[model samples]
Target: MTRGYTGEVSPGTPADVRELGTLTISKLSVGPMDNNAYLLRCRATGEQVLIDAANEAPRLLELAGDAGLAAVVTTHRHMDHWVALEEVVATTGARSLVHADDADGLPIPSESLVEGDRVRVGDCELEVIHIVGHTPGSIALVHRDDAGGTHLFTGDSLFPGGVGNTDQDPVRFASLINDVEQKIFDRLPDETWFYPGHGGDSTLGAERPALPDWRARGW
Candidate 1:
């Protein structure tokens, strides 16, 4: 159903929508950092879940429309990723979900999430994947459609060309790359399409060849 989802977004721009079989995904960029916020709505039940309330509470709420939101999943503890979290949660009264390791950083208390857990939007389910090293609690959501197409919402963990910034620490870089390679690259096929916290999107197959270069650069 995604006629032309280029995944290119910027602050103040309208969200781009992608309609999967059972679920609809809308990507919006907000804040000065251009942090992406995804709104997932279930076509069958009209239930909705927001991936991140990065900023622009009013705009995000507007994007949610009458259905509002069932929950907001913060990908990490980074400040930019949750600038509008308090406002969105306050306005919608939606449940807040964050990794246990980074829950303390949030403005409001949230349900602790971990690997193997699933977040539901009506009948659709998104599998949680805990990717460490980015912030000790960064997580990505995986949604596989009925047609076998896979979509990944990678926070600041995995990106187009390489893993997230590890602050130039070799150990952190190692941890991130290793977990990304094993937990993501090893398990998922090359056709997997990934959406990131900022900018455009890319497929695993397009980025697969650069795995060694990213690991070797130690970024």
Candidate 2:
């Protein structure tokens, strides 16, 4: 069974929960933008890693559960994505990881992360995949399960229907699309489940076939 959610969130409660084998993923949708903050836990050891401490500190702390957070990773340096970074990190005492290029934009100190780096939750490993588009240092994390499928935590750089906005420019859009197609689509298997920074989840199989359409629209 899934864990870490109270399931009765009003304005400030844990969003939702899902179980994927050894992992328990909890979400908190906060802030005026409705940004999503994710808490991923390794069930065996009760170790956790929080992705984008977007907002609602009290709610986030509640969602963090008893596993104790191992780290907090910023998907990018967008303002909307980190309102409670200081409070959350201060409360949990969890290390913060941000891409080298984007670390400067963060209000708090963080370790520099590079491509291919591994972020651990207990023994579970998540590989860093940098897809530079929405921001100079936008990134996604990939976790492979024992069943051979993968879970991709795509921040604003990717979503269900289309790529995230890139200043609404064709050039920027193309760059993001190229990076995503080459880095994520080409290398990973189609069975991957994409957990975006906002909204609902989608599978690679559900999205791959629409690449051409997305490219044509130039979003």
Candidate 3:
């Protein structure tokens, strides 16, 4: 069966799995907040990594199964994003990782991550990019597939419509959008697919035309 990557996932629905030549990305929605959690498994080595325990540890752990997680990455310090962090880490013994700025907010201690860090999943690796404003230490992970396709895991930093909320603060909003533009939009090709924390996924190309509108609106 050929599965599509529509990026539409509901809390109780099954995960949407996107299988690349060297990696498998399974995305699931969990908790009342509708946080999206991603499980990345390497095809060659069978090693896995879970991004954002989010909520519903039982469901996330069930999805992980016996292979277990090598690490759990928290995108930011938001409570909703890490509601199930402690439990999932306890059960899987996965190393906990979060950006340095948000590290203090997590329930458990984590290895501090920064830009240019590579997170290994068996034979595959994901590069980390630091995005500011949404949170002091918000970070996004970038993965390049075997076929040269780029996949981005943006926590609450970059969404489909615009950047994450900065409470309408102009300074923070500018900081976020600028960083996103320079680091993400300018550097990555339009075909790059981005997976966000809350809602559906979108290609950078789909949103490129809206940057001006988003900046003007001061969101």
For lDDT, the strongest prediction is 3
What TM-score does each of the candidates earn? 0.98, 0.92, 0.98
Candidate 1 minimal-lDDT segment of 10 residues: 140-149
Off by over 4 Å in 2: 1-14
lDDT of 2 at 172: 81
Superpose all Cα atoms of candidate 3 onto the true structure and report the RMSD in Å to 1 decimal. 1.1
Please give, for residues 164-217, the per-residue lDDT of candidate 1 as tens digits. Answer: 999988888898999899889998989998999998999999999999999878
Task: State the lDDT at 8 in candidate 3.
Answer: 95
Report the lDDT tens digits of candidate 3 across residue range 1-219.
126778899999999998888899999999799999999999999999999999999999999999999999999999999999999999999999999999999999999999999999999999999999999999999999886499999999999999999998888999999999999999999999999999899999999999999998988
| Full-model lDDT for every candidate | 0.92, 0.84, 0.94
How many residue pairs clash (N, CA or C atoms closer than 3 angstroms) in each of the candidate models, in the order given?
0, 0, 0
